[model samples]
Target: MIVNLTTLDQDQAIEQISQLEPQLFGTSAWSPNAIRQELNAPARTYWADIDPTTTPGNPVIRGYAGIWFDGYDTQIMTIGVAPQHQHHGIGQTLLQQIIDQATADHAERILLEVRVDNTPALTLYTKNGFTRIGLRKRYYQPEGIDAYTMALPLNPHTIGFQPTHA
Candidate 1:
């Protein structure tokens, strides 16, 4: 069950995501404070996939994703799934939800950076039509991992169309 995260889910989201950060992002995981700030940031949307079978009072976040949209462009901020829940389509679902939002918001394009070594993520993005646009050397920080800058152009007419005006 994918749901937009609310203020009430802040602490749980932070706690759960923090637990998965090291495994997902290596040395570049967001701190709890950073998560809090992002959640409060304007023009950003965050969502979580909750375990529907969990007890009513204790919803478990199986995966979470966030994106920042500033009218014309949407930038993916982060996406993480609990290690145990990965490979079960949670990440894909989160990705799709954000993409849907970007399309509905009239975004010209959506962009993101993924570690070059993250094959699963690269595959996921590529399968969804994102194309590599550039590379950011040593973008993953102290770990020194390179990143691939990828983009998905939402409006096909704007991205590759060269209109020959007669």
Candidate 2:
């Protein structure tokens, strides 16, 4: 249940992102306007995870994931699942879709950062072959939380590892 976030789907995407801010960042980290600005940015490529069979205006944007691919390895800008939709494989599905899109777009790798304390998200990323590569101190604002940087190298010829965290 994944699709590209085209211009026509701007408003819907904004609404969904706004709804996730409170629970995700524990604050109004992303407002509709802020989301629109980023989603509509000329330099970024956005994507949405809607029910694969749904139509426009009726799209079930339970989770939103986006990347900023500047014609190179994509940077996963943001990813969030609806509070009620968390831990139901929605995050994994969204990440896979983004990975597929990155592959289709000819990206050699995909990079992202997750809050160091976000175990569920870290698990999802680790299970998708993304490895911890670095750290971003105080990556999240407000109270200044840090994040772990991760990247997934894409190559069918190479063995992909999906580590299961205990």
Query: What digit string (tens of lDDT, one per residue) describes model 1 on residues 1-166?
Result: 9988884467887888788788888779888888889999999899989999998767888888999999889999999998999999998999999999999998989999999999999999999999999999999988889999999999755567687999
- Span of 10 residues, lowest total lDDT, candidate 1: 154-163
TM-scores for all candidates? Answer: 0.92, 0.82
Per-model C-alpha lDDT, please?
0.90, 0.80
Q: Give per-residue CA lDDT, model 2, range 44-124, as digits (tens).
A: 766666766677677877787878877778889888888887878888877887898889888879999889998998988
Candidate 2's C-alpha lDDT?
0.80
- The true-structure Cα RMSD of candidate 2 reads 7.2
Instruction: Name the TM-score of candidate 1.
Output: 0.92
Best by TM-score: 1
Candidate 2 residues lying further than 4 Å off, grouped into runs, are: 51-56, 155-166
- True-vs-predicted CA distance for residue 115, candidate 1, Å: 0.3
